[model samples]
Every structure is written in C-alpha cells, then in structure tokens.
Target: MTHIVDAAWQKILTTYGEPVPPDASPLLEPFAVLARVAHAEPLLRRLHPWTGMWELHFSRCTEMNYTWDLPYIGTLRDGRYYVEGPDRSSPRIAETDSAQAAVAMVVDRLPPGCGPAFLGNAGELAAYEKTRDQG
Candidate 1:
C-alpha cells in the first residue's frame, strides 16, 4: 500500500542525505498532541502576519469550515506524511502546495511542546536558517 509518509521520508532523505531508522522514519506523537491542542489563535497569527488583529469563529461550511479561527491552508487528498527531528540545524520550508497537511505531518512527528516557529513567509523561513547558520 502507498503510505503518506513516503513523500516526507523522501524529503528527509534528500535533505539529510541519509536513511532514517525503519521504525522512526515518521514520528507520530507530536501530531496527536497538536491535534489535541488544536486552536486557531496562534495559527491564525502565524498564517496571516499583516493583519493587526483578527477574530476567528467556527462556522459550518465545506471548504473553509474550521472549529477555530485559523485560515484554511489545504487538505491532504492523498492522506498525510510526517517527519520528526531533534535536528536544530534543519531548514524549515515554509511553503508547499499541501502546506497544511505537511505541517500536520511534521507536528505528528514532533514532540509535544516542540513546535517550530512558523516564519509566516518563505523569505522569513530562509532568513531564520541563514541567521542560525551564521551563529
């Protein structure tokens, strides 16, 4: 069967140039934790930086339906994937066609309270890494 984590695994391989542990290729704990703590305030702020302040109200709808105030990022039509890390030097890619799914996947793999800072833009993500590398 095709696995959602395959693509994320491929990404990890390409980025790290190494193979992941068989059982540890995709971490699942963080995702579950994040799901439990899912809320819109922080996510909304991260997703929309230009707005001064915003309010989110859950409404019944299809495309943009949310239980919280965060914007719709995207859904994973083909399931989802994940990657976990203690790698402090990893580069964070801020944009993807399936950014929502991707973030969920990564969250699944991460440890609780280990959320990465969403830089709000591609340039910001890049700059974060560049600055980290320089130090």
Candidate 2:
C-alpha cells in the first residue's frame, strides 16, 4: 500500500477544488486522507519525505505481485539505485555489484551529524534534526 500524497497533485486539487471519486481499492483510503491534506494545505508539503520507498518482492508475468519495504534509502530499479526527493533531483545513488552496499550509502545518511558523508544531498541530516527538535 504505497500511497503517496504527491505535492504536485495537491496543487491541482487546491486550485480547482476537484472532486475525488470513491476509490475501488480500499487500501488507498489512507492515501486519500493524505491527499486531502495536501490539497487543503499544499504548502505544508511532506514532513517526512522519505516514506514511500518500497521494493517489488515478486513480479510474475501473469500472477499477483508482492511488495515490501526497502528499509533503507531511495529506490532500486533497472539494476540501479536512486535517491529521490521532492525538493531535490533524483540522483543515482549507485550502480554497484552489491545491493547491500547501495542501501548502506542511504542508511548512513539517515541520521544527523552525517555531514557530507554522501554530499548532504537531502538537506543535511542536521536540518532534519533542527525541525525534529523544534517540533
């Protein structure tokens, strides 16, 4: 259930106040709430931006696919890892031999004080700390 309240979509909803139809999938209920929040307060944006990273556990040609959390940073697709954020451009984290190594790069940056460890791409961990502390 990787439902994201995209900021871009929120802007459209705010400007036009469009009607959101009943979703056929119940799993999307949680996401709809977030969407509504975004639509109402488009400037609020995302407090926790690194929330929607997931992995496709299994994808069969004509069978039900499985999904799970990555528990790391960014997304891995087409044999490459990418660090994505709304405020920043999606940079290629790595294209290494070990998947674990790629994930390590992201995990190492999740905490505060990890300055320039990976180029401070995501607003420096300290910035996150300041907001967290204020909240």
Candidate 3:
C-alpha cells in the first residue's frame, strides 16, 4: 500500500489555525531512511524550496533503472559506501561515516542553479531532516 501526505492541507491548517489530520502518517518515512543511507547526511536547514527531498538525476545515456529500483546503496568489496542511481554510474559517497553528511557536502558544493530537480518535495525534505536527526 502507498501512503499519501497532504502537505498543502497541513500548510493550510498551520496558517489558518486548523487542526492537522491526526491520521496523517509522517511523510517520507521509508524513502527518508533509504535516502539517508543512499545520499547520506540529510537535508540542509538553509536550502530553499524547502520540501527537503533528496533527488538524483541519472544520465539518459547510461544503462540502468531510470526511476524504479534505482539509486542502489551498498558497499564495494573494499568496504566503501556507494550509491548507483539510475545513471548506472556509481558514485562513492563515504567510507568511515554515514553518507548523509556527504550528501550535505554535495548540496553545499553545488553552484547556483546547478542543483538536481528531484529535491523539491516537502515530504521528502522533511524526511531528510528527520533522517539527519535520527543519525
């Protein structure tokens, strides 16, 4: 089963002094856990478009899962943490520490307007923040 998060409705509640849905599951719970380990580090507190989603765009020229079952997270035989997104190319993120910190480093290093497109979801963003807190 899939979980849906009504972020816009929640925003309305906060702004209009309405009650939040008591049944609302914390959004991005599963994905955040994966993104935490996959991208490492978690969301940036100061970043704009603050949905806190962690996004990775794969090259169209590469051969791999473009969207589904992609962004594989694991260790090489040498014991380094790495994630292979839909691009089929593997990018090593960290070794001695959790990769979440590395993700933060990456986002920090991006030039203006050079960031990825998948990082805009608010639920995902919140999940990233939650992941950082848990780690």
Candidate 4:
C-alpha cells in the first residue's frame, strides 16, 4: 500500500514539477535517500523555486501543505549536504560530506509525534490533534 506521505509527495511532484534525480546530479542523492528512508513520516520534499536546491519540510495543514519556514536540507557549494535551521537567518544545524550522515541528521531532528500528515486544512488538523490529545 502507498503510504500517506508517498501520496503527498506524488501530489507535490505533480504540482511543482519533479526535482532532478540523484543519478542526474550526485548532490541530490541525500535528498533521494531522505525521501526513501522517511517514506512514512509527515514530510514533504521539493526543489526551491529560485535556488533549485533540494528542500524538505514537515507536512502542514495549510493549503500548500508544506511548512515552508521549517528547517530544510541543501547542498553547499563545496559538495556537502547541510540542514539549515528554521529560517534563512538561522544557523546550520548539521553539515556532512556523507549523504547517509546528512539524511540521519534530518531524521533525528523530526518534530516530536509528527506521525503521518493530516492531509487536511488547518481547522481539520487542529480538530484531529485535539481529539488525539484528549484520547
């Protein structure tokens, strides 16, 4: 069965166009690994519209579904993968020359109890969270 996160990512690909595959550019291998390994989480992946860098973020309940302001992964000019903190001005959380290492760092930092994305609007997600919390 297709996971909810995989379906969400398919929608993102159809909407924003596909990112170049890892085979096409070695720098993107970590992104590919992240997508594969984190297939069950509430994560969304995309390419930055302006920078064309691979980006990852938690799935949100907004119209876009992606929490764009969250921490994301990008490749440095020197061919290392780095996870930037929440905003552009925020410092890098981790940087590594190995794709596995970078992917691990991103996985380790996922938000607590993120689970599968709600796949709904903010109001619905809020309701779900409230119910989940109360149970």
Candidate 5:
C-alpha cells in the first residue's frame, strides 16, 4: 500500500504537469490513512475511480458503511488538483501545496465530538492535523 502511493503521485504529476514542490509525504497522508483502513477495517464498502482522479480507489467511510469518494491529489477534467475530504455531514474540498494540509482537510471533515473513529481515538485525528498545520 505504501509503495502504491508513489506511483499515484507520479500519475498526479503527469496528468497535471505539476508535481507538488518540496515534499509529497504530507500530501500523501490521506492516502496512507486509506491504505490503513483497507488493511485494518472490514466494514468499508466502496471502491474505484476515486472522485474521477488517479487510482487509490480507497475512499473515506464510517464503520456503519457511509462513504465518500475522493481525489488522492490529482486533477480532474476541469484541471484542478485536490485531496478531497469526506462529506458525510458536510463537504470539504481543499486545494493546497502542502501534503500535510491535505491530510488536515480529511481530518477536519470528521464528525466533531465523536469517539473512536474506525481506529478508536480522537487523538489520532489530532495528530494528523498537527502534522498538517506544522507543515
């Protein structure tokens, strides 16, 4: 799953002709979470052509089966690159140069005052946001 991200990043660059400058690790955070969910959870119920962008079809979802398709960090036919976040209660679409910020967007999309996301801790989400803000 980790290795798949690099290839997806390459595709993002080729399609948009814009590689995320400096570093892509932060931008890839959401993708990492998607991979983790795929390995760790069994309730996720969706797949394919995430938000009509690059592969990494893994998408955002809740244990109850709610899901949202997203872009890992790529352009659509409209020529915009984004790492889209979940829209269960509301939607969040972010455009940024920092990979970490992209991760933060995903975290921010999480429902507030909730306990035990699929991973079972709010701090984990906070940690991702910390990385995003720090970057």
Candidate 6:
C-alpha cells in the first residue's frame, strides 16, 4: 500500500519533472514531514548547485509576486539538520539533531498569511498575480 506522504511526494515529483537523487535518501523523513504540513502547496527538492546538498524549497505567492519564504533544509557535515533563511549571508535560522525537528522549525517560521504555493513557473506565477490583482 502506498503511504499518503509517499503519494504526496510523488505528486510533487511529477510536477517538478525530476526524480529525487539517491543521495537524498537520508532526508526522506524530514521531507515527509514538510510534505504533510504543506500538502496543498507545491514542493521542489534539488541539490544545491554549489554545495551539492539536497534542499527542500517552499513557495508562496502574493497579489503581485511569489517567493520561497521558508528556508531550505539540509544536513551538516556533523549530521545535524539546518534551516537556511532566504538571505544566505545571515546565520542559519535553526539547527537540530533530527531532520524532522529542523522541518518543524521551518513550518513554524512560515510567513504570516502564507497560503498554498502557486503551482507554476515565474511567468505563470506573474500571470496569476496579475489576474488576482485585477479581481
């Protein structure tokens, strides 16, 4: 039987057009927690281009724009999980012994009034923003 979290992740993968890399297996539990909390939102799992660590991105939209408000979660060399805020130059938002705890931190820190993500590219998101603004 397929688990609900697995099913949800499958949907994200289908929409995201890329399979989770094998090295990301370590992050599955935390990813599942995030997937459960943001079930209605679209999610992206990718390897950070420079660091090559797996990261989970959360997107939210406004009347005129969309941004990944939640920090990405990744593992440190020492095995702790960390949440990095949008401003990479700043200190990490959180670090925890468990990836699930780190993900919980992310959920707790979601921006005020944040809703389900706009499921599209930047242009499509802009179009959506335009329509919403016009209404």
RMSD of candidates 1 onward, in order:
17.8, 15.6, 15.0, 5.9, 13.4, 7.9
Per-residue accuracy of model 6 over 23-56 as CA lDDT, tens digit each: 7565554444444433433232211111224555
List where candidate 6 sits over 4 angstroms from the true fold. Answer: 1-8, 11-52, 61-67
Which parts of model 1 have CA positions greater than 4 angstroms off?
1-37, 40-106, 111-120
Per-residue C-alpha lDDT of model 5 across residues 1-114, encoded as one tens digit per residue: 223333443443344344445665443444443343333322222221132424233333222232343334443333323554443343436665544454444445435432
Which of the numbered candidates is closest to the native, going by highest TM-score?
A: 4
What's the CA error at residue 113 for candidate 2, in Å?
8.5
lDDT of every model, 2 decimals: 0.30, 0.32, 0.33, 0.54, 0.38, 0.51
Ten residues in sequence with the least summed lDDT for candidate 3: 58-67
Model 3 C-alpha lDDT versus the unseen true structure: 0.33
Scored by lDDT, model 6 comes in at: 0.51
Summarize candidate 3's per-residue lDDT along 29-128 as a digit string, tens digits: 3323333343222232122211122233221111122122223333333333344432345554434333464344445544454322333353554566
lDDT of model 1 at residue 45?
Answer: 21
Clashing residue pairs in candidate 4 are: none
By lDDT, who's the top model here? Answer: 4
Listed in order, each prediction's TM-score against the native is 0.22, 0.26, 0.26, 0.56, 0.30, 0.52
Residue 79 C-alpha lDDT in model 5: 31
Query: Which residue runs does candidate 5 get wrong by more than 4 Å?
Result: 1-52, 55-66, 69-81, 85-92, 113-135
Arranged by lDDT with the best first, the candidates are 4, 6, 5, 3, 2, 1
Evaluate residue 120 in candidate 2 and report its C-alpha lDDT on the 0 to 100 scale.
28
Where does candidate 4 stray beyond 4 Å?
1-4, 10-52, 60-65, 68-70, 122-124, 130-135
Among all windows of 10 consecutive residues in model 1, the one with the lowest summed lDDT is 49-58
Model 2: lDDT to the true structure: 0.32
